[model samples]
Target chain A: MLPFARVTVIGLGLIGSSITRAVRQYMPSVRITGHDADPQVRETAVRLQLCDDVADTPGAAVIDADLVILCVPVGAMGQVAGEIADDLPADAVLSDVGSSKETVLAAVREAAPHALFVPAHPVAGTENSGPEAGFATLFQHRWCIVTAPEGTDPLAAERVCEFWRRLGAMVETMEPAHHDRVLAVTSHLPHLIAYTIVGTASDLEEVTASEVIKYSAGGFRDFTRIAASDPTMWRDVFLSNREAVLDMLQRFTEDLTSLQRAIRWGKGDELFDLFTRTRAVRRSIIDQGQDDARPDFGRAHD
Target chain B: MLPFARVTVIGLGLIGSSITRAVRQYMPSVRITGHDADPQVRETAVRLQLCDDVADTPGAAVIDADLVILCVPVGAMGQVAGEIADDLPADAVLSDVGSSKETVLAAVREAAPHALFVPAHPVAGTENSGPEAGFATLFQHRWCIVTAPEGTDPLAAERVCEFWRRLGAMVETMEPAHHDRVLAVTSHLPHLIAYTIVGTASDLEEVTASEVIKYSAGGFRDFTRIAASDPTMWRDVFLSNREAVLDMLQRFTEDLTSLQRAIRWGKGDELFDLFTRTRAVRRSIIDQGQDDARPDFGRAHD
Candidate 1:
């Protein structure tokens, strides 16, 4: 069954426009109303016919919608929620596709207190951004994490879960705090490290930027893909998920320091042990269908 | 003209077997003699017909070779070189496909002082290893950095460069020390960080191993691919390129610390700026054809 007859997606970027495309592909009868703060994005959404209607304002987007998904950056969720507060239907199931859930949950609750906020984060994305980058199959076989706080309406949470499932995502429900901590390690710290290493490589006095780019296939290129993610979205993620990200960062730094010591001291066993252990993790990921088993992450050749 | 009429490859693993296949594909007239320390690998090489002949011993492999390429762990380069020293043809252009250059150069020179030892590192590989994990086109369009020390025979260096070029690689010459320094940032340190992060994720007390593997698609999977690289090979690389790798690690740690502070202080602008700068490096990598521009590193969907 269709979870919602009318869906409003605010912030028509990669995630928003992707949702619009997915809804159209999977449930053609579901009317989509998409809105973006950037007029250019709204124009693109209209030109692409991403939704049944492209709204210029967040309020207009959700006035009659049964499901409203805020697809803006985590830092902007509160403002966007507030903008649509008066116009949102009383029984509408509010949701968001933010990277971090705790801060967004608090912001959304404060701005739309009467609305049922079923916060979610689809654990899927490419480095590309904007409405033009969206694809209907982006979320296929990926995870969608739902953060339903204590006392959440079970029916609302169930409906949100069904919605993501229809979009071809596997759904998992967790508390907002748990979701934040889990993602901090799985996503946030990885991006932070990727950005730092790319920045560090570029700033080297001995290694020319051109050299780094030329030899990046050695290993650095993978990091660059993650580092190339949208700056505004990542900045908001780091800010909104501060505590968990910091906590994970501390652990990562400690682990890295131990490795640095091992390399300095010529502890081959330590290095080998860690490298060997990590290989098993990659094997598990591939076996579980989380990633392709092909070499080089299945990167295509010329 | 063909760089060499007869080539010998010792330690017939991924790089060695790939060299064999590439020679067969590109220089069909060149006869290849292959050997490996592992008996099974030698048998497999013979079965796969990776070369014209599969020698049972390293000494036998280089006895009559016009050119000899050592393809083994960096730590084993010296031992392998020593084994072939007495059998190596006096006029053979000696070379190796080790990741690090300085130590391998010293080792090769000490083992075979009269032979022309040209150290080359092809900046190409997948996480896979062994004879079955190689392809003829692995080095195509990739950078192969050759380190020819002072007073080395110019003809020998040119021959090695032409050999790589014939196999579809672009060759650049640099001093051994300089190559180490450049690769420490561009290749070694990136591998070190990827290994460390993957290790860190698996060892986390709060996050279960399965959770990390399941959500790896988020970002952690990229690190796992690099970390899944041959443990012995990477262990040798870290130890061999100790000084340069350690230096880059220090710089990376400092940069990461700065980002950590920015996240703690909610300095969104700082995070955004660095993230934004890193994106350009990715663009340069794609433009230079060092990596594919497809989103998610062009990972194939099942």
Candidate 2:
């Protein structure tokens, strides 16, 4: 049986569009309604025919939706939830694909008291954004964490989990605060570090911009890909998950300083041991099928 | 015409094995000889037929070769150079594929003062190491910076450049010190940061290693690929290029601190601006063909 009969997705970006496409592919009878604050994106969605209906307002889109997912930046969650509150079906399962769960859950709860809120974060995305950049298979083999707050209806949460499963995701449940902490280390800190390093490389007076780009294949190019991810989304993530992100950053900085001292003091043994240990972590990731096993992520040579 | 009739690679690791394979593919008539300090690696090279002859000793490897490239760690360059010095052909042009040029050049000069030295660094590799991890097209369209010291034979430097070109690499000439500085930002510092962050994530008490590995797709996996690179080679790179790597690390840390502050203060505009600027660098890298243009380094979704 289909988990959701009528789905409404607010903020038609990569994740929003992918949900619509996956629902079409996996649950053909279900209806999809998408809405975006940006008229340009809404127009693009309409032109792309991403949904059964591209509603002009968030409230209009969720008026009859069995499942309403907010796909906007975490900072906008409250406003978007408030916008859809009056028209949102009382029985609808409210969910979101936000990076930080605690803040998003609070924002949604404050804005729509009657809604059955279940927050989720799909641990999958490329550096690209926008409706046009998504595909139906993006969630396949990827983990989707469902952080339904206390008192959330079990049926509503199960429906959300089932909805993701049908769309090709492996679902796991976690506390909202735990989700924020875990993601803060795995996702938030890495993005912050990538952005910092790329900015540092770009502003170097000795190394020209052209030189950095030309020789980036060495290792810098990998960071650039991560750093190129949507700015507004990342800005909101860092702001919304401030405490956890800050804690991770502090730990990362201390670790970086130790490595710096090792290099400065010519401690080859220390560097080698850490590097060897890290290699095992990578092997485990590959063994668990969490990452591409092929060398250079199977990048084409030609 | 071929750049060198007889080529000897004095290390059977990824870079050395790739050179032999590239030579066989691009310059078939060039006789290839190889050697490695580790007996197991030499046996593996022989088993893989990575070279026409797997010499038991470095001296034997370069006995009659017209060109000998040292593909050992930067810290081991002098020892390897000294090992080959006794039997190195008088007309042989000595070069190396080490990450840091200045240190390798100085070490090679100190150990083999009579040899015609031309230091070169091929800015290309996968995280995997050893003979089996290499391929004939590993150097295709990659940059190989040649840093030949002054008062050296220009003909020998040109021959080194021509040899890399034959191996399908684009060659550029730069001063030894400048090459080290450019690569410190482009390669060495990035690897150090990756190694540091992976270590930081691994040692976290709140976040388990499995959790980090499971959710690594967020951004951390990208760092792992770089962190998984050969330990000895990277150790030598950091130690040998200490000054420049330290300088770059200092700059990266300062930038990271600023970003941390912005996040703490909720300075969205500052974070947004830097993230937006870094996005352009990724585009330029793609346009210049320095990296794969596809999203997520073109990682396979399935």
Candidate 3:
């Protein structure tokens, strides 16, 4: 059982629902109450049996709860935190599953001044979203980055780290700024590139546009998966983590321009050199126990 | 049976081997012979029983062949066509599986003027590119875009169309320019972006680079698979399809700039608007029977 014996989970989206399932899977005896702004999601949580008690209100959910995890969108985090601030236990450790940490921690400080806020971003998810998308193994071997602001109690970060550890993830602690920068390269830029390419394909004439989607598996298909992730949630992530994402985007654009110049100038050697070197990283990724070497066609997802 | 009774497949790589396999599976009595530039691939063709008569040379393969299929690299098409131009029977139909049509068609025409040449691009492949990598089901349900010049014989184009149709592909005739434009959006640009991102991740310091790979399931992993495709082939593709790729890259840059601007300004509504719109195309792709929904967690391709 976790040190925090009683926990309140706000929102029953993919992250929230997964946490509810993980808690039940690993610590069944501990009580978990869930709060969602939408009643349909709340009712669905009850139906899925993800939570022991699906509180009709966030206030009811966190009443007397020892810990609270806000699983709302990054943009909505401040508002949700504010709504439950008075209800949160004075000594409770409050955290979030938001992708961006600085903004989340900022909001937590304002909404729940009495509680110990240790901001976290679980670097785990798929293009799929919503409550139904939750899975027990979603975070298996994935990263859970915790960005504790200055003056945050050490015990509070430890308690929050322990929460993610119990849920089957490796935890890392860094300043919120560093976490945002690292993940901007790791996740945000990839999604942005994918969205743009898909949009570019969409802008083609009706005949070829439909055909592009039809024959997307040639290479364009994988981009669509990342491009399909929840919009409002990602919108908030970019809006909140703007600086880092834009910086990385600039680097990517410049690099891509250089490549375009090489291709346009018939520099086959330059193009081949980059293409060859890139393959080594792929081999390294496979050696690191990520990615499989199987043919993409017969693979189920392709 | 194909409209042409005897088929000669020159350059037995993945596409050629797959074509040989698919033909043998569906048309058992059809006469099929294979020839590859490399002796190793030719030997593998014999060991795998991929063809009934493995020809000793390109000339031997095309001799009396009713249909001649060039499966070599796009740059090698002219030489292969020249090597066997005299061997091709007058009524024989010649075709190629090159990624670029205008270049291949022009090259093949220069080599063999009288023989019917229908240029094609099979929109199916894996990162692995060798005789051993070929499988019978590779072309099943994949698109095969054929670009025959305006003056090319209709009977010749239809014969090539019938051949691929027997292999379970939906074949379409397109202008070489249009084929380049559409594929520039669908295949080339996506590959260039993936290669760039994987290369960037590889340039990181040892520790974070290792973690970037380890937890690549977040997004970076997919790029790695594409980055692993044969170096020489992709290099040649970019060099040959330069202009169209550059044009598409320009549009993509503009779109990325808009997105970068939105992120810089913390425009939540704009981010939400674009990201939300991108997801619908993925849905349409799935509905079109192009992409599958279940995210492909990297496959094991040896």
Candidate 4:
């Protein structure tokens, strides 16, 4: 049996559109409705036929749905929840795919106190964004962290987990605050560092930008892919998850400082030891099937 | 006409083995001799038939060659140059594929001063190492920066560029010091940051190592690939290119500090603007054919 028979997906961006597509591919009998704040995106969703019905308003999208997933940026989650609060079906399970959980959970509770909310974050995405950039298999083999706080209905949380499982994600339950911290290290800090390094490389006067782009295969390009991620979403993520992100950033800065000192003092042993240990992490990531096993991410050499 | 009819490569690691394979594919008639300090690597090179001849010693490898390229770590360039000094051909164009040109240039000048030394760095490689991990197209469409000092023979420099071109790389010429600075920003700093962050993530007490690896697709895995790079080579690179790498690191740190402050102060606009600008750099890297254009480095979704 399908966990969600009629699902409404708000904010037809990458994650939102991917959910609509995945539902259609995996649970064809379930009705999919999509709504986006941007008229252009709404029009594109209709043009691309991403959903069974493209709703003109958030309220209309969730009025008859058994599940409502807010796929907007973290900063806008509360507002979107408020938009559909009045019209949402009484039995509908509210959820969100925001990167940060604690803030989103709090915002959502304040906006729709009566809704059965279950917050989740699918740990999958490409650098690309928008409706067209998403696909049905985007979440395949990826983790989906479900943060259903204390007192949340068990059935509602189980249904949320089942929905993600049907969409090809491995569901893991994490405490809201703990989820925020885990994502801070795994996602937020990486994007922040990538953005900073790419900016630094581009701003260098000694090295031409053309030269930077040309020799990027040396390592810089790996960062650019993530540095290229959607600006608004990342901006909201850093702001909403500020405390955990800042804490992780502080730790990263200390580590980086130690490395800088090692380089200055020509302490090759310290550098070598850390480099060797880090290699084992990559091995685990690949061995766990979290990444491509082939060299260079299996990027074609031809 | 070929750049050199007989080529000798010392250190049959990733870059060295790739050079032999590339030579056989692109310039089959050119004689190729290989040598490695490690007996196991030499055995692997011979077993894989990476070169026309697997010489027993560095001196024997270059004794009759028209061109000799050192593919060992930057820290070992001086020692390897001294090893081949007595047997190097008088008219041989000596060169190296070292990441840092300035140090290798000085080392070659000190040990094999009589030989024509042209320093070239092929800005390409995978995280994997050793002979079997290499391929003929590792340098295809990559940039090979040839840093030939002013006193070096013009013909020798051009030949080095041509040799890289034959191996399917686009060659550019830069001053040794400038090349060091450019690569310091583009390559060395990226690797150092990757190593540091991976170490930080793994050492975190709140998040399990397994959790970090499982959720790495969120962004951290992009780093692990480069962090998995050969430790000894990277250790040598940071030490040999100390000033440039440290200078770049300082700039990166300042930028990161500013971003960190923005995140703490909830400066979403500043974060959004920088993130947007960095996206263009990724576009340029893809436009220039320096990186794969496919989303997620063309990682298979299936």
Candidate 5:
């Protein structure tokens, strides 16, 4: 571990504070700094021991740092990049934990053209956010996806991978476009469905809505887990990755319609086949140890 | 409690065995008997000590019982009811633990018109189902929805409500038709969406599908949770509750299209506003003290 000498983590929210906590635990001797545009987060970061030094501005935080990680919502990557670009030292390994690649990369490239930027997203988070929600083990057993555009410096990407490896994450490399398409099906579209359904439930009259909550096991609780994710962060994801998300949403909608039609026509086999097939994926997740048999105790917040 | 003298439970599966385990804890002297069409469930009931007595058939289980709880899939309720209808004692307080109300009620009326049948659904479950999965507190703090048709005896409904209350559940009453509609929004639609999304994910080429599971936190994980639920049980739910489910699904499809359009147009505010509104319902579940935050641990079979 490079001790991430003079590491600057932008945006002291859930992911930011978590990285801070993990660094404090795993690399105690390293000098760590945190920055956030929000005044409250800065104060909270100081109170929560999230950093050795709290910087009021992104430029101050990134100055001469070996690594600068943009931890803001996907929509704000550009603004943060613009703020810190001038202060970012040469040879610094710049990276991001943003969900969408194309949008985040576009922003970083536009602002810090000279920096060795490696866009990466670590797939782990709770529904909660802010400094207090940070935990050191949040990254444990999670996958960190690194999307480096063609012709990137191999050494820069390798260093970024090593950084995450130190943080206790499994790493994989892929093209940015592949990341977006896969995430569109895996993350973006699923979020859209969850949000829409939860919105639909919320729109119900208060009485029925109350019933919906009380009897959430009727299936509504599953949607709520996805729906409870950070609104600003997800909004930025949808807006930034609009085309791919929309494209995946189209496929999902068509598939859902056919399912609806099957149910309407009392196609027992169709419903059974689909339901049966879906179970194998869940089984595979468990078989791979990606999922545990433990109930939701580990996810109390959700 | 009545000690539920001679309680007979049909379908010694997850819910049935759980009811037996719960009843044993709360009413230990009840002499709970269980019956299942599957021999494995019967054997597991014995191995797991979920019931005091194992009956050979539904009729044998119902013999001399004060309370007979039907714990079969929605589709199997009618057959079980028919098998036990002739053997049920005149004063038996009958109830069911099926997810759907209308179809189950219709079958009960057809098979056991003379028996005092009350339709009930415990809004609690795990991804895994079996006698071995039963726990004494399975219904603790969960909601139990009861739907009693008009002209039905009030005493029967009250008995059913008291029964669930003893098992540590709060009860809500509604008409069967209304229960089906509300559940269509709360449970059925969310489940269908999950199954569909998981199915789409599994259809991805092998490499991407594995990555999808490995990096599931991006939202696909929630769908997988729901998709992991019992295939036969869920299939029966969709088939038995076809019209209401399809209706809600249609509404969901329409709402999803509108969301797709918003994502396509990069309407960040629209997405944020919708996502923000979805949190309240989850808050309500937490407020109701029904939200089990244990992740997959508290609910699924380990």
Candidate 6:
């Protein structure tokens, strides 16, 4: 059974377009309506046939959608929700693919107070953005964190969970605040660190940017992939999840400072111990099917 | 013409085994000798037929070889060089695959002053180690930094560069100190940051280790791939490249601090600018063929 028969994907970016493609691949009979703030993206979505209908605005997109998903940046979630609120079906389940949950939840709830909102974040993406950069299989075997606030309609939440499952995601439920904290440690901090290191490497007077690019296989290349992610989306994520990201950043800084001290003091044992422990974490990630067991994250082959 | 008629690889770990495999694939007529400190690894090397013969000791491995490459931890480079010093052929070019170049050059010169030495670090590897983890094309399209000190035999250095070329590497020559500084920013700092972040994620008191592993696809998993690298090798790298790594780390920390403050103050513009600039680095890396342009480093398909 299809959880959502008429789905509206607002903001036809990577996540939105991916959901459109996934829905088409998994449930061919379901109707998909896509809308993007950028006319260029909407044109691309139409050319790609990512949705059955490419709406010119949010209101047109959600007027008849049984499931409305806002895939815009978190900072813009409230405005988008407000734009579609009057046209949204009373029975529609409103969700989003924002990385941060708390701010998004508050914005969505305030804007669409009468709508059945079941916020979700599919923890899956490539560094690329826009409608053309998405694929149907991007979420296969990945996690879809469903952050439905307390007192949310049970059936609405269940339908949202069912929707992600059909799209090939493993669903998990968590409170909005808890989701922000968890994602802050697992995603936001990593992206921030990657961006900083890439910036640091590029700004060095001794190392030319070309040299950094040439020798990136040593390890820097991996960080560059994440750091290359959409700037506006990440900026919104950091700002929306400020408290949690800052808290995690504090811990990471402390840990990095200790490592810095160890390097200065020539503490090989301390370095070895931490490195060894981290290897075990990678093993667990692979064991849980969160990543491939192939070495170098399977990047060496290419 | 082949650079050398005979080759010896000591310490049959990832780098060593990869050299053996690459040589066998690219230069079929070149006789290859392999040795490792671990008896079990030597047995595995022989079983895998990674070389023409598996030597039980470093001296035996280099006895008749015209090119001998040391593939061990930086901290062990001196000891390994000394062990093979008595048996090194006079005409043989002694080189190493150590991540740090300056200290390695000193160690090789002190131990085998009569023999020609050309230090090389093939900026290539997977997280996997030992004989079974190697493949002939591991160094293909990868940069191999060749560092030959002042007054070194130019002919010997040329031969080493030729050897790497035949094995499918792009070779670049630079001073040992200069190589260390460039790598400190490009490679060493990246590894150190990845290790630090992975350690931080695992040690978090509020986020369960299982949760971190489960949601790793968000970005933490990329860091884990490099963090899962051989601990002893990385330990030796940090200890040997202390000054350069420490310097780069300080810059990275300061950049991170500035970003943290931006986030704290909700300065989204600052975050967006840095993120946007970093994207260009990734683009340059892809254009140079240093990394796959495929999204998610081409891990999405798997």
Q: Provide the RMSD of all predictions against the true structure, rounded to 1 decimal.
A: 0.9, 0.8, 2.7, 0.7, 2.4, 1.1
For candidate 5, the docking band is: medium
Candidate 3: TM-score, chain B only:
0.94
TM-score of candidate 6 on Cα atoms, chains taken together: 0.99
Backbone collision tally, model 2? 0
Give stretches of model 6 more than 4 Å off.
Answer: A300-302, B300-302
lDDT of 4 by residue, B1-302 (tens): 99989999999999999999999999999999999999999999889999889999898999989999999999999999999999998899888999998888888889877878889999999999999988999999999999989988898899999999999999999999999999998899999999999999999999999889888989999999999999999999999999999999999999999999999899989999999999999999999898888999989787
> Residue pairs in steric clash, candidate 6?
none
Q: Per-residue error at B231 for model 2, in Å?
A: 0.8
Ten-residue stretch with the least lDDT total in model 5 chain B? B293-302
> Candidate 6's residue-wise lDDT over B102-126, tens digit each?
8888877787778788899999999
Query: How much DockQ does model 3 earn?
Result: 0.55
Q: Interface RMSD, candidate 3?
A: 3.0
Q: Give a tens-digit lDDT track for model 1, residues A235-261.
A: 999999999999999988999999999
Candidate 3 clash total?
A: 7
Q: Evaluate residue A275 in candidate 1 and report its C-alpha lDDT on the 0 to 100 scale.
A: 91
Best by DockQ: 4
Worst 10 residues of 6 chain B by lDDT: B293-302
* Runs of candidate 2 exceeding 4 Å displacement: none
Clashes of each: 0, 0, 7, 0, 14, 0
Poorly placed runs, candidate 4 (over 4 Å): none
* Model 6, docking class: high
**Order of quality (lDDT):** 4, 2, 1, 6, 3, 5
Q: Compared with the true structure, what per-residue lDDT tens digits does model 3 show for residues B1-302? A: 36778999998888899899989987778899999989999899999999989988899999888899999877788989999999898888899888777777778989988778888888888877788988877777788998989998888888888888888788888999888877888888899999988777666553277667755766777777788887777887787788888888898888888878877777778878888888998888778766654554333212
DockQ scores of the candidates: 0.84, 0.90, 0.55, 0.92, 0.57, 0.81
Residue-level lDDT of model 4, residues A1-302, one tens digit each, is 99989999998988999999999999999999999989999999999999999989999999999999999999999999999999998999999999999999999999999999999999999999999998999999999999999999999999999999999999999999999999999999999999999999999997999989999999999999999999999999999999999999999999999999999998999999999999999999998889999999999887
Against the reference, the lDDT scores of all candidates come to 0.91, 0.92, 0.82, 0.94, 0.82, 0.91
